[model samples]
Target: MSSRHSRRSHGHSSGRNSRRTTQNTAQLIESLNTHRVNTLTELCRIERVAATASDEDQLAFQGPMTSAWTYYVTSNNLLSELRGLTRNYPFSSDALDDAKWRVSNDPESNRSWNYAWLVLIKMRDDQMVEAYAASEAAKPEMWGGRVPEAEEARQLAECFAWEWNEALEQMLRHWDTPPTTTGY
Candidate 1:
């Protein structure tokens, strides 16, 4: 299976897209310009916020970074890495191999991608056993009540949280600068 998701080129069909461009993005860009901070400073601030946001915050930092890494890191290919490792909670050996292959050929892949891939390649043989075992660790039994279905879902969330958390940490640790522009 292909490890990468396809994206439409930004602002293709200019007239048609302009009619669709909402004020939100424009407003956000204007607001970002309103601040006097350098690009790196603002990016660092965003990384800090994304890393510690609550679940309800829609930032995913409390658990897995998942797609959130795209916001903090510049590489388009790193998304492929995360998508592979976290695919089905990140356990299939074949998928892991594909992820490593996908990232290894890209010279511009983010440093965090290399770090995360290194971390996962070591688990290729055992991640499956380890993940479900983690899922089992959170299952609680009760005397008179059935375990809630939410508990089951939480276990799945917990199953991949550690690996993704490490991924997020690597992103935060390796983030350096913005592209095509001076960091300041």
Candidate 2:
């Protein structure tokens, strides 16, 4: 082949590859946005159902709540993937900032807090659960009593509360520092 022909072919190939890359990045960003919206929707649905559930029906809501929690966690993963994909892209800075703002302002962002609060309220309204908790509370020794399912639920709620506080503290610390150019 002639040198000029070879050079032209190579240039064309490179241009095609660049265009493909750009297209893929745009698609990924769109997917990230879709995932974010879906996650938020699921979170809101779970919150609404849990909030409106009666004491008798609250137990039935647990599965949906757990599913929402899993989706929320998955949303975080999608956000991380988005950050990685856009790290060196020209428009990443604004995109990343907007994403972080969306996350920070998400209605159900505080999963642990909301879950804990809902569980506590549900348990409080359940007479059987409250009786179990009260009996356990009356025990002289902290570790000696048999933990009823209700008490276990309360403990789980408390753990969620702890996780919520820890996450909040981490967010605060992260915000205190200037944005670093390192990891996404």
Candidate 3:
């Protein structure tokens, strides 16, 4: 083919590629917006359900708790996508702020702490054995819960406090160290 003909063909292909890239970017932004709206709506619903749920009404708590867990997982994925998208495109500061706000304000943000409280309550009320048995078969390996005796619970809490103090001490020691210019 002639150089002139090849130049025209290359130009046409590049134009098409540029348009396609623009279209994909628009679609990504739209998807991010949709996900944000949906996630926020779900979070609000979860909060409402949790607020109205009674401690004795475990059934009522299940739906909202499950929804909260799902929202946590889904929002994490969306946030990761948003971070990547924002890096490539000039996403609005407001959109990024909103995403951060949603995560910070989530009602079930401290899931591990909540679970520990639930377990302690159950144990205190003498409901732990039954609850643990019912939940055991479906429990994930990393899930935190145990039908501990009162003394056992006390020991566990003490141990945790000691470990936390040790960690803080270690962190303090590291903070006192001066920065090294060497690669080491």
Candidate 4:
């Protein structure tokens, strides 16, 4: 048996180091959700299993990983931007794959969403939340005690209180649009 499998059975983290998210986390979560909402038109159907699985889980990790990796790399314009003070590096393909594996294997995944649109948005949001939680739980050596309130530091918190109220308002507006298809 691998050490990783053994480790998985036991819960990790002592929970002593976690820190609450600041306002900047709220802002980035907003930007991500806004970007998701603005671009949420369906691509052509996958045609293999619409009912069995979302085209989202069907979409391979590489495509989105490439986009996300590039996004941070370009936006921050530095290799050091790959990680926050207390988190995993964005450039690690293995870590990214492990994350995808964990989520895909989650038994409760996709239980609440019917459409691909909603499923994709919800999954990405869930990942962001998890990353924040994990980052917050670790007291990194480099921090020397407390992470600063800088933009980079704020991105990794124990938990982000997402402004779902505003997001719900945006989502409600999206739903308010007239239906495009006539069939039930």
Candidate 5:
């Protein structure tokens, strides 16, 4: 329906125009698919051995959407921090919900750990190899003490990737035009 970069400035420049029209939408979609597949594989591998303590390893897994939500939350927080927020933004539903809970239970803890909680618990724990690698030992437990299985993680990653890409595409499409202004 809408195309992103329609025209260039000044002159025609045949070579430049050719490359501009060579839309990479298909390539981008393929890349997204590959990312999802790779993410799912990594998730499956890590979930096998997340818990350090005995008997803590057998917790039931979460469904896909929740898992993917965790991934999005973690990724978003990382991106936000890289961009430098004066105060951390709530990047995930889980983090936001935790913050809400803290507002009632312990509001003071809401700032830092909420973001970290989603990252370690939801994102890192999904990968089994990443769990026992010593580095993750320092990671906090947001689930109280639960680990999602590979299947759950995969479904979550795939679903989240699909939904997110779709939403992003939609947003990009809407960016083509500015909103009309009406005044009295």
Candidate 6:
């Protein structure tokens, strides 16, 4: 019985394929780029807003600027670094153009991604936990009257929101140019 038990394999051969798929930095960035562009394009078409709205908005001063940084700072930082390395101090027109295309389509993808990262990093932050709790509490339907689903959702949202807010903060903090109050 002992010998038979020892012969029993812990995992099947197919289990080797059960490993989680991990994207390389470049691939990850590319995926994000695709998502951002698609999201922005759909959002613009759906909202009947111009694709250039993000461009027109000041990078430092505008609400969208804040919002953009608020969500996808890591993606922005990594891409910016890559661009700098490949194109020198001033980014090439082609790189800027590509970014513009993506930003135009999925303006908030950055935000969503950044928020998701933040949630993962600091799950125990009081503010985040509270926020998630609140959201979960709001989903009263999930509890069948006894459970506080909304509170649970709120907790989850809180975790994500912190990350997004941090990413935005990072972007604004590192911005070289002083935010222009005047129209750009």
Per-prediction count of colliding residue pairs? 0, 0, 0, 0, 6, 27
Pairing residues by index, what is the TM-score of model 4? 0.23
Question: What's model 4's lDDT at 169?
Answer: 32
lDDT by residue (tens digit), candidate 4, 1-184:
6788657544343232122222323333344333331232221111112222334432442233224323432343222322332144233333333444554576654442223223223334555445533454343643667655555455543233132223323332433322112210
True lDDT of residue 52, candidate 4: 26
Q: What is the TM-score of each candidate against the true structure?
A: 0.24, 0.28, 0.27, 0.23, 0.21, 0.23
TM match of model 5 to true structure: 0.21
**Every model's Cα RMSD, please?**
18.1, 18.7, 20.2, 24.1, 21.3, 22.3
Q: Candidate 6 on 101-137: residue-level lDDT in tens? A: 4444654434432332232223323233344334434
* Evaluation by TM-score, superior candidate among 2 and 5: 2
Write one digit per residue (lDDT tens) for candidate 3, span 1-184: 6999999999999999868755644443344344442343343343343344445433444444444434444456433433333343222233333434444565543443222122222232432323322333233331355455555555444443343334323322321221111110
Model 4 segments beyond 4 Å from truth? 1-39, 42-99, 107-131, 134-184
Which residue window of length 10 is worst by lDDT in model 6? 43-52
For each candidate, what is the lDDT?
0.41, 0.41, 0.39, 0.34, 0.33, 0.36
Residue-level lDDT of model 2, residues 73-118, one tens digit each, is 4445433433333333211222223434544565544444333222
Off by over 4 Å in 6: 1-102, 105-148, 178-184
**After superposition, which runs of candidate 5 have C-alpha atoms over 4 Å from their true positions?**
1-145, 177-184
User: Between which residue pairs do clashes occur in model 3?
Assistant: none
